[model samples]
Target: MTDFRSRCIAPEPLAGLFCAIPHPTGVEICAATGPDFLCLDGEHAPIDRERAEEMIRAAQLHRVPVIMRVPGHLPDSIAGALDSGADGVLVPRVSTADEARAAVAATRYPPVGVRGVGPGRAAGFGYRIPDYLATANSRILLAIQAETPGALENIEEISTVEGVDVIFIGPGDLGVTLGALGPEGRPKLMAAITRITKVSRAAGKAVGMFCASPDEVQGWRELGITFFLIGNDARHLADAAGAAVARAREGF
Candidate 1:
């Protein structure tokens, strides 16, 4: 399996795409599209455990690393995704260092964390239990979303959490939280993004964020954000369909 966590921390930047459609075929399609990794959006999407597990398998078949974004920081939410063979878990709505720690703990096993011992597909269904246990602690990535104002205030502390791998910013949510939703609010949003990136980088952590377009990715990359989750499958599909419809109408 690819060590996506290590790649994220590597000298160069890493780019990835998001999959919101809750199906194995969608996972396979995204994997085939070839990003460095894929974030399975279980948080906003209606993806359940069984579908997630199947998607994980689909990703593995295509040799793509997958990180499931759980709805919350609950132990079950985190563990279930890992057990289903996801390479990592992204906990959303993390507003404090404590919540960041809890997210990390949920991804780790005993002693280091309270994560239980049901390995399932991640451990090769008991066949690779020893191998899994020996490396899971270091292998699994734990990313916490830092989108709210409170999270930005505690950004440094959250970044310094021992097991926290990535401090991913939800720009859309952050913009709403900061009351800066349009072009008029670009300055404030950029300032907040810059601050979070600088603090996170200073703490020796990788920074990630959502990029709606290539322009946003370039801007964030300049701010030292290496991990990027670019557009989702649904949006891409809609845009393509809309374009085709417009072209057909013009021809007719």
Candidate 2:
């Protein structure tokens, strides 16, 4: 599997899709299609650790790295995702450098941060604890969301936070927060995204964001942001299914 962090920082853009179906089969299907990575959504989906672990195992079977978008910044949430053997953790709503630091702290171990050691799946069930501990702090990618106005104001500081591999912009929530939804608000939202990308690049951090359509990829890439999560499992399924049904109805 390509290292998630390396993929994020590489010059070529990393393309990924969010797997929100909360099932191993769903993840397997997406992985088989081959993306640079897969983000299993724990924030909006009903996925628990067991399910996330199962999904991770499924994706790794295809040698696809997985980043778990944990529901919150709490230690336990981050720990659960990492323990499930997620390639990284994406913490949402991280508005300040302090919150970013806290998120990274929970992700690293001991002297580096506060994460307690555990012989979880990522450690090969206690068999590879030493190796896992020796490398995890560096191997695991730490991505924090910049979705609020506060995050926009503090983008420079947050981007400079150590161990924060990717500064992901949650355009949807941010649009809502900035009242930058729809046509009128899109310019405002894009402006915020542009600012985040600019500051993050200056700080040598990878920038990521959610794109509603594939067409937006190249445009965003021009902004020096590489990581992108465009579309999701549910949307793909629904679109294909609907298209098929529409075709069948036309025949009828």
What C-alpha lDDT do the candidate models reach, one value each? Answer: 0.88, 0.91
**Candidate 2 lDDT by residue in tens digits, 1-252:** 656677676545889999999899999999999899999999999999888889999999999999999998889999989998999999999999999999989999989899988889999999999999998998899889999999999998999899899999999899999899999888898899899999999999989989878898888888888899989999999999999999999988
* Each prediction's TM-score versus the true structure: 0.96, 0.97
Local error of candidate 1 at residue 160 (angstroms) = 1.1
Q: What CA root-mean-square deviation does each model show from the true structure?
A: 1.2, 1.0
Report the C-alpha lDDT of model 1 over 1-252, residue by residue, as the tens digit: 567778877635877888998888988988987778899999999999999999888888889999999998789989999999999988999999999888888999989999888648888887898899899999898888888999988887888899998889999999999887899998998899889989999999989989887577887777889899889988888888999999999978
Clashes of 2: 0
Please give the RMSD of candidate 2 to the true structure: 1.0
Q: Which stretches of candidate 2 lie over 4 Å from their true place?
A: none
